[model samples]
Target: MKLINKKNKKYIQVFQLFTEEEWTKSAKNYNKNISSFFSGKKYEIFIHTNEETVTYLIGLGKSTMQNFEIQQVAVKFSQIQKEKIQAVPTLVLADFLKEKQFEEFVKGLLLGTYSYPFDKKHSIWNPKFEIHFENLSQKKLDAIGTKSEALVNGQTACQEWLNKPANLKKPDILSSYLKNLAKKYDLKYTVFNRKKCEELGLGAYLSVNQGSAYDAAFTIIEYKTTVKNAKTFGLVGKCVLFDTGGISLKDHNNMHYMKSDMGGATAVIGTLIYAAEMQIPVNIIAILPITDNAISERAFLPSDVITAYNGKTIEVLNTDAEAG
Candidate 1:
């Protein structure tokens, strides 16, 4: 669903967000019939049929919500209402929230339209969403919608990468995606391949990479903002494409889920992409030490000793503990 600039149009349903305090004070003035059917509990929802339009009362227990919780309430509203209502749902936010909170609400509302990732399968999120806030200018709403949609898109990208099967997320394919993403945003991208990593004395990381036949690398993605005196934040994400646990093999029961071993790196890419697009006045340096810990002729043994990038030595007491 999306926000529409056009107003005065009819909507199938009106979704109203409410906090516990707001609902308590308002419900006291309402008729007994309406008050009995609904309370202002967290995540409580009551659907009422008006003369023509259906109204949905959605509750968020407290007036003060953490930024993420604010987003979650919106997301839950989006999901819960999806089955009952279709296109052009008008969402009445509890208040004319501040800019950041407003943006988060819009972002979470749009995120409701995101479908789970599947290989060779696609789902389109449609149905325009209209915000029914009293004071927000259309131009301001449009700006928030754009940034929120970008963040949602970035989140979906990370989900897609993390959920892909191991065969589909091979090291080369993963690296190529990162390289292209960097180019798209004009960010400085440096990938130290096997030979380069060897020279950098990344023996600990390389030892983990030694298991698989696929090519591996230590990738660094840098995002620089022109904002004067912006601080640089260093981030490291585990990029193990698949973790088979090397010689200390894991149980076969849920091995398929190993595809998501790169979750940390995936999130880093998503966040970096959004920050770059928003020009959020911050420099980000993300390091993704990439590989799959699959068993092969060159897999590291359980008790191997390796030197790390910072001149520290580590004994592989258990190969499965490579990244633990």
Candidate 2:
């Protein structure tokens, strides 16, 4: 993805408007009528072509802007234009929008164009478009660029991990990946293997691991800052790499997507990466309980009573309720 300044005026001009009046004024240069061409609805795109240049006008619906609205608009634009849009210069008409809004706009564009072609030979739409922002200071532009890149990179990593096949993304593999990430980011990490889990009396976590051939891994990621008496945040993620419903098996239909049962873990990892990259001044502790629920002779059976790590015995009503 190329990010160029507004010096290159030859690219396609993209404008965002809040109201019909704003849309009319913005489209005046293109010699087009707003109402005749397209409805001034939120996220509605009106493409105009002339012998000289091509321009796109998008409506923001109301006067106030929201983060998700920006993302939705960008996503719609990306879908319609696809890879054909090589260069786009965004013209922000709403003066109320600040650096954060610009950052969100850039983030929306990056995320909207993102596609995952897992295990495929080639991607269908790999957009390599250049984004240019107009009427922004150098400092704001730099900040936007940095923020957008970090957000996109973090989201992309999470998406890839979630999309990976269950066979390739078992408990051990995810633990190794987190270890490598912690090392790369200079974060403190601890991995508890099956033996360590048993020693530490993590019976609740180990109970879910009993049926799988792969060993369970409990991982802890710590990010510390230099601020004095900083607030500490604890995040717990359910790292069920693949849930097969255990003894109470699910239907084979669409069960392949069960690999994404570990989405909570992926989100935590992504948040940690983004925070580390941006050097956020806060202490964070992330706990990932990684395992898979499979059917085996050793699997926990319904109506069986088991003691958890807290020394509390509970009756299992259903093996598929492992997440509880």
List the candidates' TM-scores in order: 0.85, 0.85
Q: Estimate, for each residue in 140-208, the C-alpha lDDT of model 1 and write its tens digit.
A: 877787788678767878888987878888999988998999999989999888888888898888898
Quote the positional error of residue 12 for candidate 1 in Å: 3.7
> Which 10 successive residues of model 1 have the least lDDT summed?
118-127
lDDT of predicted model 1: 0.77
Q: Which stretches of candidate 1 lie over 4 Å from their true place?
A: 1-10, 28-31, 64-67, 89-93, 96-100, 118-127, 138-140, 321-324
Model 1 scores a TM of 0.85
- Residue 116's lDDT within candidate 2 is 64
Model 2, span 1-324: residue lDDT tens: 444446554544544444455665555555555568665567777776667556566666665656778667766766566645644343444554566665666677667665664321111123334555556776677777777767776887789889888888877788888889999999999888889989888876777788989887788999998888988999998788988888878779978989998899889988898888888889999999889988888888877777788888878777773533
Cα lDDT, all candidates: 0.77, 0.72
**Per-residue lDDT of 189 in model 2:** 91
Give stretches of model 2 more than 4 Å off. 1-21, 25-29, 32-34, 87-97, 118-130, 321-324
